[model samples]
Every structure is written in C-alpha cells, then in structure tokens.
Target: MSKDNAPATLPPVKRRNAELVMLGVALAVTVSAFGASGLALDGSLPVGMFGYGIGFIAITIGTHVALRFIAPYADPLILPLAVFLTGLGLAMVWRLNQGDGDHAGAGMQLIWAAVGMLLCLGVLFFLKEPRVLQRYPYLFALAAIVLMMLPILPVIGIERFGARRWIGFGGFTLQPSEFAKIALVLFLSAYLVLKRDVLSLASRQIKVFGFRVFDVPRLRDMAPMVVAWMLAIMLLVVSTDLGTSLLMFGTFLAMIYVATQRSSWVIIGVSMFLGGATIAYFLFSHVQLRVMIWLNTFDPEIADNEGWQLVQGLYAMAEGGLLGTGLGAGRPDQNFAADSDLILVSFGEELGLAGLMVIVMAIFLLVERGLRVALASREMFVKLLATGLSFIFAFQVFVVLGGVTRLIPLTGMTTPLMSAGGSSIMASWIMIGLLLRLSDNARKPAPQAIQDEGATQVISR
Candidate 1:
C-alpha cells in the first residue's frame, strides 16, 4: 500500500516505562528512610541496607519486567503505588523492630514480600483472562467458605488474643480470610454480572423521602445478597473479626451497586451491618470491648489493657505532630499490632501528618486507577471484578486508618501492602495482578478481524 493508503495508529502507551521510573523513586525513598532511621537511632548507616535494597530492587524491577511482557498496557500507577506502600511498610517494620533487639520481623516481612511478588508473577503467568474466572463462580464461593471455615477447626485453629483467626501447620501460621477475600470478590462479581438485570428490574418498587428509590428484589433475587450477608455475619460470629466482616460486606454491597446501579442496596447493606454489629457489641465481650475502647479510650479502668494500644498510638502521633519524628526515633512498640493494624499510626508518629497524607494520597491514586480500569472495561464480569477488588483497598484502608486514628472502633484489619501479614501481602499482590490484567485488556488495542468464506478470524499481535 502507498504511504497515504497505509493504516495509521497511535503509538502504544509507555505505561511500563512509567512504572519502572516510579519504582526506582519508591526504592530510593525506602533506602533513604532506612538511612534516616540508622542515623537517628545509632548514628551510622542502617543495618542490612545493602541486603534489603538488593532484594527490594530485584523483586520490584523483576515484577516490572514481567508486567512489560504480560501487561504492557496496564495502568502505570498501580505497580509503583504498591511498591511505595510495601517499601514504606518495610521501613516502618524495620524501624519498629529495632527496639526488639532482633531483625526477625523486618526480615520476615521482606521474605513475605518476595513470596507475594512470586504469587503475583504466577497470577500473571497463569490467568490469561480475568473474565475466565466468571465461569466458576460457585467454585470460588465454596473456596471462600472453606477458607473462612479453616480457622475454626479444632486441630489447626490457633487461638491468639481470644480469637481463632489463624491456622497453623508446619510452624507457619496463616490467616485464610485474607486470601478468601479475593475468592469472595470473584464469586460476587460473577454472580452479580449474571443477575444484574433481575436484581435491578425485577424488584418491587419502593419510594422513600418522596423520591423513587430501588425496587425491592424478589426473595429469589435477594437470596444471593442474603447469602453474602449471612456469610459475612457468620464470619463475624465465628472468627469475631468485625473488620473483615465489614470489609467483605461493604465490597459486596459496592459491587452490587455498580452492577445494578442501585443505591438502595448500599443503604440496606450498611444498615444491616450496623444492626448486626450493635447486636454483637451487646452480646460479645470482645466486640463490646472494641466499641467501649473506641468510645472511651482514656478510661482509667480498661485503658491499661484494651485501650493501651490506641492510647500509646495517640501519644506517639501527638509527639510526631505534623512533621513526624524521623524514622527510627519514635516508639511504635508501645502499641499493639504496631507492624500491622497500627502501622499507619506508627508512620503518622514518625513521618508526621504530612508523610501520612502522602501515603494516603498514594493509596487514593491506586484505588482511583482500579476504578478507572473498571470503567474502561466492557464486560460486566470484568467490570464488577475490578470494582470489587478496588473497593477492597478503599474499605480496608478506611477501616484500618480510622481505627488507628480513633475515628472508628479498632478491628484487626491490616493495611494492604503496608501490613506485616504474609496472607495480606499475597492477597494484595494477587489483586494487583488481576487489576493489571484487567487494565491491559482495557487499554490494549483490538486485534485485526478478517472475514473469509462466511467465517471471521481475528488475530492479536
């Protein structure tokens, strides 16, 4: 074809390049944080700087390279944002562990991060299409159930702090609920995609506050949402994990809203959760203590036991003020779950409000990009999956940070990528993998479609 007759197409996006550059910056910041910690704590270079830097750069750069090959058109912001959070978390964990006279926690976190990245790579390698998961919604749902149930078993269920939320085998304890969340999202997305029409159109019409609201779903239509609610409630009852329950239910409700374009589902979901939580608070001592502690954190009676963690966190945040205390100089060890639940408060104490805001903004960007991917996708299944996964981050962050800041009752939810749990890290990276794949499908150019002898053949380059 002549130059004038030749096809014209825009150049492919430089998303991978952008990710690489941002990853570099994130790594540098992590190293700088370590340096600052060392200088403040012992007046020398931080311990294990070279080893940590090498491991971080290796895993992150390798992950970026994998993305270039598998999801070249994926959103640029997700990878770097994840690395940034992980790096910051590692820094915080390392600094906090310095007071322990052992390098175990930070070292374990690094190992977990590596394992998580490997899982992410495995996802990219195996899951050719995110929509493929829609074919087995029931399977995913069952897996989620089993995962939730595992921690309640008598033999392997390991109890800690009055809750059996972990299962220990072969000396490595695992929190199954963290990974169950992905399966739950998958099942919910697939279920909603198939039922969106019925849920949105087949419901009884209801008007409230003089405005037409959602149509009440049929008993059959309501079954799925009911099951989801029951499962969340069951999880709360069995594990006494209010945070996971809220996160799961909230994600399900958000996906329902997106799928059906109905706000009533969200209202109903939130109200139901609040009612259940109120009931639990009155009936369960642990639940009641969390609420009481949240309400009266400074009470001299329980302040030494249930409220001590939060009070110390508040004191640390106050000490840091708006600018933080420089990485290694603060005492996050005074708070319980300093490396997981209260990590944000720890960061706030040392990095100050400014650094905390930076972290929050980074998280906001990651969530925004996930939502954007959902909007960009054409398939209902893919859209709902992205939305559900994205909302997990939004809800989890709010739950953890709000608890730490005393805005809400403390629950045992860990910040994604910024927490010390292996399951949380792996689950988060898996979510990133799905997001990257979905974003790739969203932004990648369509293949050529050809027609020959009543058959159309398409080829992807």
Candidate 2:
C-alpha cells in the first residue's frame, strides 16, 4: 500500500504510568501521616515507620506492576485510592497500638493487608473470565448461606459485643459474613441477569378506571426477592447483625433495580426490610437498644449504656473541631472498636473534618469508577456484577460512617480498607480485584474483525 493509504497509528495509552504516579503520591501521604503521628505521640519517630513505608510501597508498586501485566486498561485511580485508605488505616492502627503497649494489632493488620493484595492478585490471575461466575449462581448463593450460618454453629460460633457473627477456629476468629457479601453479590448478579426480562415485562398491570396505576411482578417472579427477605430476616434474628442483614438485602435490591429497571421491586424490598426490622425491634432487646441509642444518643441513661460508643465518637469529633488534634494527638484508644467500626470517626477526631472529607472523597471516587465500568461493559452479566459490587461497597461505607456519625443506628460494619479486621480487608481487596478485572474488560479495545471465505469472525476470547 502507498504511504498515504497506510493505516494510521494511535498513541499508546499511559494508564499504567498514571497509576504509578498516583501510587507514589499515595505512598508519600501515608509516610507523612506515619511520621506526623509518631512525632505527636512519642516526641520521636516510631521505630517501625521506615519498615511500614517500605512494606507499603512494595505492596502497592507490586500490585501496580501486576495490573500492567494483566489488566493494563483497568481504571488507574482505584488502586491508588484504596492504597491511600489502607495506609491511613495503618497509621491510625499503629498509633492506637501505642496506647496498648503492643504491636500485635498493627503487625497483624500489615500481614492481612499483604494477604489481601495476594488474594487480589489471585483473582486477576485465575479469573480469566468473569462470566464463569454466572454458571454457578446457585452454588454461590449456597456458599453465602453457609458462610453466614457458620457463626451460628454450636462448636465454633462466638458472640462478641452481643453479635454472633464470628466463628472461632483454634486461635483466630473469622467473620464469614464479610466474604459472604461478595458471594451473594455474585449470585444475585448472575441470577438477575437471567430473570430481568421476565421480572420487568411479565408483571401484572394494576389498572383503575381503565388507567394503569402500577405493575406487580407475578408471585413466581418474586421468588428471589422473597428468598432474600427471608434470609435477611433470619440473619437478623440469629446473628443480630443489622449491618450485614441490611447490606446483603440492600445489595440484592439494588441489583434487582439495575437488572429490571423497575421501581416496584425497590419499593417491595424496602417495605419488607422495614417491616422485618420493626418486628425485630419489638421482639429483640438488642434491636430495641440500637434504635433507642440512635434516637436518644445523648440521653444520660442510654449514653452510659448502649449509646456510649456513639457518644464518645461524637465528643471526639467535636473536640477535634475542623482541623482535628493532628494525627496521633487524639485519644482514639479510649473508644471501643475505634480501629474497626469507628475508624472513620477516629480519623475525623485526629484529621478533623477536612481530612475526613478527603478520605470520603477518595472512597467516592473509587465507587464512581466502579459504576463507570458498569456503564462501559457490553455484557448484561458483567454490567450487573459491577453495579452490585459498587453499590455494596458504597453502601457499606455509608452504613459504617453513618453509624459513627449518628446519622443512623450503630451497626457492626467495618469501613472497608480502613478497618482492622482480616476478613474485611481480604474481602474488600477481592472486590477490588473483581472491579479491576471488569473494568479491564470494559475499557480494553475490541478485537478487529476478520473476513473469512464467506463469513466474518470476531475474536474476543
């Protein structure tokens, strides 16, 4: 072909380069936080500051390299945002450890962070096709059920802080519900993709005076929602975990909305959840206490009892005011579950509202990118999966931060990437991995078409 007729060359995408640069910025912020916290706490740099910085850089850079190899077109900002949150969490956890006179919690968190990254890598490596998950929706649903139920078993089930949500095995206790959330999302995404048509179009039209008022799905088509409602109610009754029950059912509802584009499903889901929660509130003292605390957090009687955590967190944030007490200057250690349920509140106390907003914005961006991936994807299953994962991630953060800020009743949900639990960390990273994979598929260029003897072929696999 002549030079003028030759194909035009496009510049290579610099997505990986952008990711590397943002990772560096995130690393700098983390190191600075560690240094600042150490100086404020002990009048000297912590002995492990360099070690933590090096470990963080290593893990983040390593993950970036892996993405370049496997998912070069993935969203560049998500990894850096997550690293930023994890690093801040580490700084806070380590600072809190100073009050306890031990490094166990910080050390364990670092180890789990590494494991979470490895699991993320495993997802990218092994999950060559996200659609494969669609093949076994029932299995994923069953796995979610078993995981949620594990903590209720007689031999291993353990109750902590009035919630039976963890299973003890030997020395370590694991919150199986954290991972169950992902499994449930997978199942719902797959199932909804297949049933959306029926649920959306096969509805019974309710008309009055020859005008259609509303549409109701057939009773058979409502099976998924019914099962979800029952499962959520059972989870609340047995586990007393309002957060997980709300999260799972909420994610299911959101996926149903995305799949079917129907408002009635959401209305039904919300009504069922509210009714079930109201029943539980009257029947269970724990539920009643949570509601009362949320309603009257400053009431002296409730504040001294069930509302103590929320009250303390509110006071800390108030004390910090707009600028916070500067990293390690606050007494976050005085609050129970400060490293997990109240981590955001802890940040608000030390970093002030400004720093807290930065963290929240980072989370917002991560979720926005996930939804963008869903919008970009061509497949129904992939789109639903991305939407489900993103919604759950955002909702979990909202639930945790809301509880701490008294925007809602306190629940035992941990802030993802910013919490101090192995299960939560690992599950969060796995979700990130899935999001990266889906984003890669969404953003990567489609294969060029080819002409055969008498047919055309398009290569995607």
Candidate 3:
C-alpha cells in the first residue's frame, strides 16, 4: 500500500504514551518527596525505589491495557485519574508507614497493586463482552452473598479491631466485602436491566392533598432491595462493619433509582433506611456506641475510648490547617488506626486541605466521567453498569469521608485506593477497568445492524 493508504493506527499508541508521561511525572514527584523526607529506608536505595516506582508504573499501565479490552471505548481521563489516585494513596501510605514503624503494608500494597493489575488485565482479556455477565446474575448474586457472609461464618470468621470482617488464609487476610461489592454491582445491573420496564410500571397510588403517592411495591418487585437491605444489615449487625454496610445500601439505592427513575423509590428507600437504622441503633449495642461516640467526639468523658480515633483524626486535620504539615512530618502515628480508616485524616494532616481537595476533586472527576459514560451508552446493560460503578465510587467516598469527619457515625470503611488494604486496591482497579470498557463502548459508533435492531425493539416494546 502507498504511504497515504497505510493504516492510521497511531492514535491509541499516542494516547497511551500521554498517559504514561503523566504517570511518570507523578511518580517522579512522589519519589523525590520520599527521598527528601529523611525517612528510614527499608532496603537499599536502588531496590526500594525501583520496587515501589516500578510497581506503580506497572499498575497504571496494566490498568490502561485492561481498559482496552474490557471497556475499550471509555473516557481517556478515567485511567489517568485512577493512576493519580492510586499513586497518591501509595505516597500517603508510604509516608504513614515511615512514622508508624510498619514498612510492610506499603511494600505489600505495592505487591498487591501489581497483582491487582494482573487481575484487571485477566478480566479484560477474558470477559470481552458485557453481555456475557448477564447470563449469571443469580449465580453471581449468590456467590457475592456468600463471599460477603464469609467473614462472619462461625469458626472461620476472624475478628479484628472489634469487628468480625476478615477471612484469614495462611498468614494473610482477605476482606470478602470488597469482592462482594463488585459482584453485587454486576448482579444488580443485570437484574435491573432485565426488570427495568416492569419496575417502571406503577402498580397503585395513594391520593393525599391532591398528590398521588405510590403504594408499596409488590413483594416480587421489592425482592432485590429487600435482600440487599438484609445483607447490608447483616453486615452491620453481625460483622459490625457499618461502613461497608452503609456504603452497599447507598449504592444499591442509587442503582435502583437510576434503573427505574422513580422518585417514589427514593422516598421509600430513604424512609426504610432511616427506619431500619433507628431500629438497629436501639437493637444493636455497637450501633448505639458508634452514634454516641460520633455525638461526643470532643467530650472528654468518651474521648479516651470510643471517641479516640475520631478525636485524633480531627486533631490531625485541624493541625494541618490549610497547607498541611508536609508529607512526612505529621502526627498520624499517634493513633493505631491511622493507617486504615483514618488514613484520609492523615493525608489531610500532612498534605493539608489543599491536598485533600485535590484528591477529592480527582475522585469527583472520575465519577463524573463515569456518569457521562453511562449517559452516552447506547445499551441498557452498559448504562446500568456504568452508573452502578459510578455509584460505588461516589458512595464509598461519601461513607469514608463522612466517617472520618464525623458527618455520620464512624463505620470503619477504608477509603478506596487511598486506604492501606489489599482488597480495596484490587477492587478499585477492577472497577476502573470495567468503567473504561463501558466508556469505550459508549464512544464507539453503533453498527448499523445494532441500530436497526434497537429501533425495532423500541417500536415493538
């Protein structure tokens, strides 16, 4: 073929290069900070820096490669944003580890990030079509439920930090809740796509002040939400992991509303959630304790016990003020929980409000881009998937931040990507990969046959 007739295939390569360049700059900044902080190094300079930096770069590149397979038409900004968040999290975790005398989590986190990148690529390479997931929503939901409940399964369940939410395996621990969220999202999206029309149907109404309020949904119609709510409640009451429970419930509610587009559903959901929470607050001792602690974090009476973590987190945030105490020079090590649930507080302390705002804005941008992908999607399944994933991101952020800031009762939820948890890092990357796949699909021009079939289906419906 002539030079003019040669295939135009450099766009993707160019885009990937741009993403790599951005990541490289971020990595360089992070490495520079680590070196300048005068923190004790775990290993030789070459080995430590190379291991950490290469691991991050690999994860970022692997995520983008996975997106090419799973969500080939996703927004360009999504992958880069994910890389930034992951890198920021790693930086903060490393900094905190230096002070806390536990360099293992940061190093282990790097390893997990690499493993997670592989998982992302595997999902993308194997699960090439979104429709393939629709065939097994029931099975997936059941598996997800089992995985979620594993942490509380009689003798097998392991308790940590006063919560039975971990499954121990040979010297390591795994949080099934993380995988459960992903499975639930997929199952919910599939279920919603199948029942979208039925859910949109209004069964009955109650007239009040010239306004007709919808009556309660039939048992069959409410089964999904009922089961989901029960699962969430079980996680809260049994495992005492209120953060994950609340986040899962919120994500479910968001997906249902998006799926059915019913204002009544939202109202009913809120009512049910509050009613259930109130009941649980009185019924469960743990729930009551959290509420009390949240209400009195500053009170000296409870500040030493139930309110300790919150108080410390608040202090960290306040001490940092607007510009932070610098990356490696904060008091995050003053509390034991600083590395997990209170990591954001630590980030806010060392990086200041400005740094925290940057992190928050990055998350918001990623989620906003996801919603855009959902809106642009041509298929119901793809739209629901995108929206569901975005809700997961948004809900997780809200729950974690709210818990740290005492906007709500603390639930011990780990911040996504930023928290020092293997499960979270893996699940987050998987979600980003899925979102990129959906966005890619959204960006692609619809084949003529699909357009024609969609038109026919709409007309017939």
Candidate 4:
C-alpha cells in the first residue's frame, strides 16, 4: 500500500515520552518556585541551588526512568502529577523555613522525598501483581489495627498538639495512622470482593415513602460493616486522628457501595457515622471544641487559642486574594502547622486563588484517573482496591481544604503530597505506586497464548 493509502489502524504507542516531557515541566516549576521564594525574600537566588537542584532533579528523573522501564504502559499523567505536587510542597516547605531557620528545612524534606521515591520504587518492583494482595486480607487487617494503635502506646507513643498520634525513637517520630490507611484500603478491597454477593443480598426490602429504597441485610452480612464501624470509631477515640478515621471509614463505605452496586449501603454508612459523631460530640471535650470552633471560629473567646490557627489560615487565604503575594513574599508561618495541615493555605497565600484552584484541580485529576483505572480493570479485587485508594486520597484533600475554608469541621489531615510530614509523604507515594501498578495492568495488553499446542499435546498423550 502507498504511504498515503495505508490503513489508519496502528499499534497503540506507550506514552513514556509524554511522561518525560511533563516531568521536566514539573521539575522546572518546582525549582522555579524555590528560586522565586529566595528572590521574594532576599532579592537573590539561593547560594546552594547547585546541590539542591541536583538532588531534586536526580531523584525525580531516577524514579521516572525506573517507572518507564518497569511499568511503561502505566497512566502517564499520574507520575508527573505526583512529581509536580511533591516539588511544589518541597518549595513551600523551603520557603517557610527561610526566615524561621532550617529546623524543618527543605533539605530534610528532599531527603524524605528521596526515601518516599525509593519506597515507592520498591513497591513497584516487588508487588509484581496486585492480586497477590487479595490472598492475605486478614493478615493486613491485623497489621493495620496494630499500626493504628501503636501511636497510643505509652513507651514509644508521643502526644503532641493534645493528640496521642505519634510514635517516636530518639528524635524520630512516625505516624502509624499513615501506614494504616494503606492496610485499610487493601483489606477493604479484598474483603469486599470476597463477600460482596452476601453483603448485596437483602434480608428484607423496606418501602420508603413510595418506593422500596432500603435493603435490610441479614445480621451475618451486617457484622462486617458493624465491625468496621466500631473500629473506625475506636481509632478516633484512641489516637485522636479523626481525619484518618474518617478517610479510612469513608473509603470502606465507598468500596462497599462499588462492590454491591447499591446506594443503600452508602445511606446506611452515612447514618451510622452521623449517629457516632453525634454521640462523640457530646461525650468528648475535644470533639465538642472542634465542633464549636467550626461553628463560630471568629468569636472573641474561641479565636485566642482553639480557633486561632483556623482563623489565621482564613485571613492568610483572604489576604492572598487572587494573584497572591508572589511566592515567598507572603507569610505562611502566621498560620500554625503551615507546612502540614494548613499547607493548602500556604499555597493559597503565596500562589493565589488561581494557583489554589490549579492545585485542587490537579488533585481532582489524579483521583479521576484512578477511578478510570478501576472502571477499566478486569479483576474485582483490582477494581475495589483502586477505588478505595482513589476515594481515600480524594477525601483527605477535601476534608483538609474544607476545614481550612470553614466548609466543614476541621479534620486535621495532611494535604497528601503537599504536606511536610515524612510519614504522610511516604504513604502517599506508596499509594501512588499501587495505583500506577493497577493502571499498568489495566492498560497493558494481555498476551494471546496458543491453544492448538495444548489440544495437540493432549491428543498425542
């Protein structure tokens, strides 16, 4: 056939090149943000750009190159999106440390980023197939529970910010809740896949108003959700990590809905949560304080301490307006936990409303892509796992941003890749690797094996 008359059908191409270009852009944005911070603060570039730039670029490029070789068919956008968010976070962390000294410096964050990438690489390398995870769901469930409870242990557990949510050794402290989230996602995915049929079966159909809207499930089927519900509430009470609890439970609820294809499961889950929250609100002083602060943050009495951080976040965001103070010129430190919980506010103040919208949209894209992978997967376990990971990721971002903007009670979760905590960054990266692995399986073409050989061998035998 002539070149012009050639068939339009062509083999699908791997988008590794597209990913490489986007990675370059991401690295540029990150380095530029850091440089801009220096200019805004001292009217000059940093003295150690050579070392910092080399470290940052090297880690990013190395991770990307390994991903291209290992999982070339994986969704191209996810890795780049993660890189951009991580870089932007490191830049902001660096920006915040400029005047306050390098106690929580970008140097340390770069090291953590390297560690996160390395761990992420390890997941991609060793976890060759996600289906293997489905085989040992109960094992992960125990690990998850133990990890969540570790933070409350007296010896190693360290209480900070009135919450017993960290375990430390010497100078190092880790949040087990971060790793627990991974286990929760895996457990819910595997368990739901195995028992979805029973869970979907209705013990009785109840008429609501004009339609039969509710499914009264057998108590046996209900036991799983009941256990999950109690565990969520227990974590909330013990670790005081309400955000993690909410994220974990919400993901489970979402996975149940996906597995059963039932809206009723969602209804039941929400009702159970609301009822538990109502009880907690009255019984727990911290919960009451959180609710009160959410309702009336600007009030004089509450603004001094309890609501002070939130109010400062609101003011900083407002001050940023649309264009922001141009990177480092704005003071993000005014808000407490500026590099972690209220990191969104830091982006808003320095990057502006437009910038914040871009960030939120990027997060939305990442979650959307994950959902796409879930929809495309052939295996039920893979679908549920991807769905759980995606939703929890999205819920964390929404709750944190919503809390900052007074849209909901502040459930202090780190803002995914944008947050400064080592535990959070590592966990987020590992989840990203899992998502990438899932996507690669979804996109990669299955080999067509010869069936004739088997038949001939059998006949000959």
Candidate 5:
C-alpha cells in the first residue's frame, strides 16, 4: 500500500459481521415476541398478537431510525436488542393491564418510549463529539446535583412507598435521579481525563513493616469524588433511595478505576463505601427496615406485609417454570406493585424463565459489545464514556435483578428499557445514544494520521 490506495480499502468482513449480528437480533426478538404473545393468549394468537406485533415493529423502526441519525456506524446489534427488551416490557405491561384496567402506567410507558426516542435523536444531533461535553463538566455536575435534590424540595416532591424520590409536574412525575446518573457520568469522565496524570502521580508514602502505604489524596484531587460520595449517601439516607445511591457510587468507583488503572483504588473505594453504608444503615430508619425485610422475607410473620413483594415475585418466577405459564394466564397482575419495579417478575410469571433468560442474554450481549467498543476506541474520553455507560447498564441490571430475587435488599430501581417510567426510559436512550456515538467514532479512521498521509501524497503528486 500506497497512501492513496488506503482510503479505498473496504472493511468487508467487519461490515458483514455487523449485518449478520443485526439480522440475528431481529430474528430472535421477533421470535421472542411471538412466543410471549402465543403463551399469554393461551395459543389462541388473537388478542395479544396484534399488540406484540405493533409494539415490536414500532420500537424497532423507531430505534433504528433514531440510531441512524445519531450513531450510524455503531454496532447495529444494540438498537435491536434495546427494541427487543422494550417489546418484552410492553408485552408484560399489557398482560398486567389486562387485569387492572385502571392502571395507565403501560400506556404512559409507550408514550415515554416515543419521547425517549426523540431525546436520543436530539442527543445525536447536538452532541456530535464527546469532546464537546468537556466544556460543560461543572455545569453538568451542578445540574445533576440539583436534579438529584429536586425531589426533596418542598411541595413538589412526592414521597411514595417510604422514599421521597419523585418530582410531580402537572399530571406526570419524573425521577430526577435517573437523569442525574448520566450527568454525573459525564462529569466524572471529563474530570478524570483532565486529572488522570496528577492523580496517578505518586505522593507521599508511609512504610509499615516493609509495606508502603500512600498518604491520603490531596484535597483538590479528592474533591469531586468526595462530593459525589456525599450526594450518594444523602440520597440513600435522606431520600430513602438506596438503589440509585449504590448505582451512583458504583459508577463513580468504576470511573476512578478506569482513570487510574489501579486496583488499590478499588480496595479503597470498597472500604469507604462499606463504612458509609454501615453508618447509614444504623442511622436511617428506612435503611434498617429494608435490611430487616431482606433478612426476614421468608419468615412467616412478615411474609404477608414487608416480604409480600419478594415472596410474590419468587412465586411468579417459579410458576413461570422453564417456558412460563403462558403470558396472561399468570396471576401476577393480582399482586400489588407488579407493574413498575417488579416488572421482571411479571415477565417471568407470564413469559416463563426462558423468556426472562432471553432478555438477560440480550442485555449481556449489549454490554459485551459496548466493552468491545471501549477497547477499540483510541481516545481516552471515548474509552471512559463507553466504560461508564457499560457500568450503568450492568449496575442497573444487578440492582433490579437482586431486588426481585432477594439476593440483596430491595432498592426499588426500575429495570432499564423495560421499566414503565419516563425518566428511566429517557435516560436509558440517552446513554445508548452516547455509546453509539463512541462506537461510531471508534470505527472511523484517525484524523491526524489520515490527514498527514493525504498531505504527503499531495506533495509527491
């Protein structure tokens, strides 16, 4: 190769692989949707089939069209995966609404999905490059903090199920914490890139029996993390929202590790998190209640009250068995709070364990592809952005799954893309848009080298 010839080189294998992956996802999703509707309608395939078909096509087309404008070159697999998850969610929501016709959350969820798609397009159009975000770190951080605190404001904040985590606007409600997560991630990425070298530079060290222990971080270097930690703890203790706090803290820790590439940071971060959690557990009454409920979910006395949700969820999952009870046949809709946070359990009850596993696999594939994008990206900012987005996906999934399965204390976090909430849907789409943008940028040839070669060729000519 001549420099002039390189521009014409085709990435045939990569393009082919991308197309194959997209096709596979589309087929899998369509099959899953049909299975869910088939099972739910008792194999009659009349009432529920139309809903499944329309929902799948609408979401797939909407997501694909939006992604084309935002991140055309990014992994074509992610949009379909997201659409599949959304379709599964819609099916579960419709199944639930069949029993309680008064519940309008599913309807609202569909509207939110449309709105989220629009937001994804907006992000793609406005934020053409990750570097443009660097100019607004402070602004983004401040806005994020304000949003996190909005639910605590007088008169506007709504306290539901013991957590003051929602802000009611007119007839609708928004969870500011969801948006805050994205803002905080952007802030951390920008801050970390700017300070990575300074933070990585070794400061003073103390020798303790042949072991060297570094001194505490400088006040300036520790400021942002400390502030984030404080915000997280306050959200947990004051707002009684443990899931978002844990998520935010986990995300901050991941970014810190990425910035420094040091396992020591992980050790220190975990220790501090545990210390704060222990103190909060004892100090906050709601935290104590959650811990007690988690510890005693199986006990006969509390099983009907505090442990009712988890027990019901487990029953639903078990009832689902391998293939599920055939969608609408399951009685999870009879239970309280079956549509929102425990939506996954509803999925298991209706779609079966097989359906739930398919959803999980989709999420796992999406995350794995995101990690590959992160690995391929040459820019530090893009790498950090991808890493942060991956952490968000992983953390959200763990929290929701853990809550449903009783593996951890219930945190009341909505399932991403699947949960019936406006904030959750919008925030998720935005995160997906960012990941797509980063992937597109990663696939593009480096500007400096390409430009240099072009200049040299021109001189030779």
Candidate 6:
C-alpha cells in the first residue's frame, strides 16, 4: 500500500487503427457473401464478384483515410457497421437481379454507394462545427418543406404505386423526403434547444380535487408542435405517403421528448397521431386498404389480390425457418419490393432468423453508439441533434420491420443502408458523417492548461 506503487495514468488511445482492421473484416464478409451467392446460383463464382470487391475495398480504404484526417477520434464501429449493412443490401439486389436478367439495378446501387461515400466525406470536410447548423433553424425548416413538396410538383414529380413521392431527373428518380428527414431533424434540434427550458418548466397544470392532473403548454408555446402535426397531416393528405408522414412527425416527437424530458409531450404527440391516423383512415381509401391488409392478410378475399405481397413474404420467412435456404436458394423476388421496402423479408428468406438477427443487431449497435455520443456531448444542440438523428434511424427501421411482420399497417419506408434506394443511401451516410463529427468533438481530449512563469507573483509578509 505504498503511494509509489499506485498505477500511473494511462494515455488516451484513439483507435483509428482498430477501425481500419474492422473495415477489412467487414469487406471480407461482404465479398464472401457475394462469392457464396454467386456459386450457389451459377455453379461458379460471379463474374462481377472481383470487380465488386475491388471497388468496395477502394471506397472503404478511401473513407477510412479521410476519417483519419478529418475525425481521428470518432467512434470506430460506425463505418464498419454501415458498410456491412450496405454490402448485404447490394448482394441481395444483385441476387434479385439474376432472376430478371437485368444487372442495371445492382450496377446503379454500386454507383450510388460510391456517390454516398463522397457526400459523406464532403460533410466531414466542410462542416467544421456541427453547432454552426443550429443558427439556421428557419432555413432548414424551409428547405425541408421545399424538399417534401418537390415530388408533388407538376413538371418533375412522378407517381408510382399510388404514392406521389418521387421526382424524376433524367431517367432516374429521387425521393426528396429522405433528405427532408435530415433537414427537419436539424430544424427540430435547433428549435427545441432554444425552447426546451420553457417547454419543460413553464407548463400550466389542470387540477382535479386538489391533485394536479396534466400539464399543458401555452397555446403560443405549442405553435411548433402544432405546425409539425399539421405538416404531417398535409403529407398524408397530399402525397398519401404514410411512411414519410409518420417518420417526420415521429422524429419531431422524439426530439421534443429528448429536449424537454417530459412524458406529457409524448402522450400528447401520440394522441395527436392517433387522431390524425383515424381521420385519414376514414377519408383515404389507401389508408383503409393498408389497415385491411394488415388485419386480414390471410383472408381469401384479399389474400390473392391486395394482400398477396404480405402473404408471400410471410410464407417465404416461414419456409426459411431457422437456418434459411442459403443465400441464392430462396424465392424472395416473388414478393413485391423484394429489394427495397421488403428487404428484411428478402434477407430473412435467405439468411434465416439468425442472419436477420445479425442485421437487426448491427442497426441496434449503431443507434446505441449514436446515443452514447449524444450523452458525451457538451453542447445542448449537439446532444439533441445526435439524439434526434439516432431516434429517427431507429424509428425508421422499426416502421419497416413492423410492417413486414404485420405488427402494423404497411408504411412502405425503406430500411436505412439496406434498401436499393439512392436517397436512402445518401441520407444514411450524411447522418453517419454528422455522428462522426459530433463523436470527434465529444471524445477529443480537452486542451491542457498552460502555466506562465512570468505571471506568478511572490507574496511578502
């Protein structure tokens, strides 16, 4: 028990090397999946496998090197996890393409992956301080509104599957709502940071027989929430895009809850959502059809018609059972959107429950690390921004999984990083870049205090 025997303080370690190693492992897994899938389908390795692996390795190494210069102290697991999910998605898209003899989808997805990584790098390079984004809440809000409205415009807007949520540019289509989700999160984080004190502490209470019942914010103070709710309703009514509507509003509610830390806000938000959904259900045939399909998926009445996709997806998973039919053996393409919105089902049918669990766990870990960064953040705006981003990512996954499992009506939202959508990939990487920047700020060691000999004065008695 001598003082000299105490352990010396250890230096802080920035695990950039650890991140590079994990990225290699992630790349190996993806290449292996591609190779295995090709052999199973064609009795030989895929012709494109080598090219795909090389391209992916280049992107991964480039991204890792950029991170070393831009954000050396960022969380290590995030990039690897995102890459693994995206690779799996690309593999599945390629697998589906084999049946149709159209390689364009897979080719386009790979191109988008590269584009997404470049955009991610841009974020780290240009956005020197994440807090700078907090200054333009109204600007962000306006951008979000414009992005959401893009698909409904006459010239560029294009309708598909009864939902007008895509805008055509050249021969390709883009979903503006995905980008809008990010902008809205920024706006919400900034707005909530400025008003959290009042939202949390300045609520008026209603009393019942000497006991306080519920606290309500003032009408003037409730404007933001009211506007968000109304915007969500408008999305549903105009675009008939239930997924985006629910996602935008759900993120808003979640950010507000994180900012204010009040259960009443959540209660009020959920009540408002239920009321809006009920009204939409009565007024919109699309909403009613979705609810009916959810409730009566197996019914012969619609099973062969409107519910065919859900039924086929369920049967595919059931057939997959515990270990799955192996990567190229399942008929996942029989279900609609096998490579996009129902990607989880596609994965389940081939990889089985165990494989599906791995994907789900990867997403869960990403969210957990994001929240940890939020907790470590020193600034209120950064904390709220990180929290909102994490919650939205988690909530989007939940909405997709819930719809596929029949736990809720289908909302048709793409799974982040695991869907064959350019917008989803770009937005996912943008959020990842933001998380990396915030994490760097959170974990960077504070500047050591400097001592000046000239500043020291001797006191005389």
- Quote each prediction's TM-score: 0.93, 0.93, 0.88, 0.94, 0.87, 0.94
Question: Stretches of candidate 2 above 4 Å error?
Answer: 1-14, 205-214, 449-461
Each candidate: RMSD to true structure?
3.9, 4.2, 6.6, 4.7, 4.1, 4.6
- Stretches > 4 Å off in candidate 6: 1-11, 206-214, 449-461
What are the per-residue Cα lDDT tens digits for candidate 6 across 229-269?
Answer: 99999898888888899899999988888888777787888
lDDT, candidate 2, 370-455, per-residue tens: 99999989999999999988998889988988888778788899998989999999999999999999988777765541133114
Model 4 scores a TM of 0.94
Number of the candidate with higher lDDT, 2 or 4: 2
Pairwise lDDT winner, candidates 1 and 4: 4
Ordered list by lDDT, greatest first: 2, 6, 4, 1, 3, 5
Q: Write the per-residue lDDT of candidate 5 for residues 269-350, one digit (tens) a residue.
A: 6777788888998887889989888988889877888888788888879888998877677788876678778888887877
What is each predicted model's overall lDDT from 0 to 1? 0.85, 0.88, 0.78, 0.87, 0.77, 0.88
lDDT value for candidate 5? 0.77
Better of 1 and 6 by lDDT: 6
Would you list the clashing residue pairs of candidate 3? 70-437, 71-436, 71-437, 72-440, 73-439, 73-440, 74-439, 74-440
The total number of steric clashes, by the backbone 3 Å criterion, in model 3 comes to 8
Count of clashing residue pairs in every prediction? 2, 0, 8, 0, 3, 0
Candidate 4 clashes: the total is 0
Q: In model 6, what are the clashing residue pairs, if there are any?
A: none
